[model samples]
Target: MHFTAEQRLDGGVLERTFTLGEIPGILWTPASTSAPVPLILLGHPPLGLRTMYPRLVDRARRAAADGFAAATIELPGSGDRPRWAAAEQARADLRRAVAAGGPVDDHVVDALVLPLVEKSVPEWQAALDALLSLPEIGGPVGYSGGVISIGIRLAVVEPRISAAVLFAGSLVPAVLFEEARRVTVPLHVLLQWDDEGNDRRAALDLFDAFGSEEKTLHATMGGHTGVPQFAGESAARFLARHLK
Candidate 1:
């Protein structure tokens, strides 16, 4: 139950890591705590490439300072101690496959796609379940990620997450959209204006399908990576509004 400090921040940021089920994450919490607070389950990009993404780490620290328990989870196949062999290479291969055929053209990439998806989903679900069980977290939680954000949308249906922040990820295969409709929580999707690969229109279609009246769509100037900084303040505001 003890966590190892991973980083130090200004204004009393304390970083630690916790093993939740089979997954582990670096958590940033404020030094001063008076009571139990809501939690944010931050899903980092695939392959742990963004483990050192400064904006993301800063956001977690700010969330802690703002009085929410925030943690950045290194997904099943994405941490330094990944469960899979050559995890980054495997992820890169899949990305190449997706890019070759376009996001919606699953027929061209299902051979490589299915197994990777299956391998990663369970670990995400376990992380979500563990976060909800923590005394510091309330019923509703906020999720954010790039491509892995799609996986989070798929896994979060049953537990009923309160609010979700999806960045540059899509709900493809139509069936995934059906699952997304089951999420009654507020969903804020951020995408680039000219994202040719992921197709901003696809994200719009998914937003149209969302069941919540509180759903929002914001378009920024840059591609995938641009979202974290563009939407950082908005993300903080959204979490503040809904996580409480």
Candidate 2:
């Protein structure tokens, strides 16, 4: 990661902007963190990181306050990375299906998700690589995001991420359910019961696929944007237990 800009936020959170070959990312560290702290990789909605800016900032800030270094990079097709010619088409297809109140087909799912998986997993790993090399970051990595599929992938393949907090609000492909079985790390999954556009069955199925003996499912009553503030506090406590 090549850092291009940086500034300190309120509460002594150091925010640094970097680019992994045009992929913009931010690294956040708390001022009180004098020693190496656990790292967290934050995943955002597919629309882009910008759409989730408020929650992202809140999450990052809360994590930093709890003495964890939180970070997030732009997802493929969302940031500085050039979009594939078919990217919009894939999105439109999924949108149409959702608008029709029908399930997105396997082909559409493959088109929409395969590219993200192919491109994003490596980028996140790269960000982890670069961040882990810093003296201020190390050990017991955690991941938090609503992009639950990506979290599942990372939990399966990235052994360094010791714990994760996943937001269950998407339709994951069946193959990913298989990959979910490979994840043995501790997980804390949050499911907003009435979240719009969320496939509750899929979320439950995906949660069931996690092989981790330590996985916990947090179900709350709310919509996508209606998640209660207390949920965040509970999640922070969970991360603190395992990460701090």
Find the candidate with the highest TM-score and give its number: 2
Question: lDDT of each prediction vs. the true structure?
Answer: 0.63, 0.84
RMSD of each: 3.4, 1.3
Instruction: Please give each candidate's TM-score.
Output: 0.80, 0.95
What lDDT tens digits, residue by residue, belong to model 1 across residues 1-244?
A: 3365566677777777776554556666677766666777676555463555576677787788678877666655555554665545545665676667744445433433445556656665666676666666554566665453354455354455567777644535455566667667777777777665566767777778777778788778766555546477787788789877
**Position 175, candidate 1: lDDT:** 52
Question: Model 1: residues >4 Å from true position, as ranges?
Answer: 83-104, 108-117, 128-139, 148-156, 228-230
10 residues in a row with least lDDT, candidate 1: 104-113
**Candidate 2 lDDT over residue span 124-192, tens digit each:** 898899899998898789988757778888888788888889888566777887888999988888889
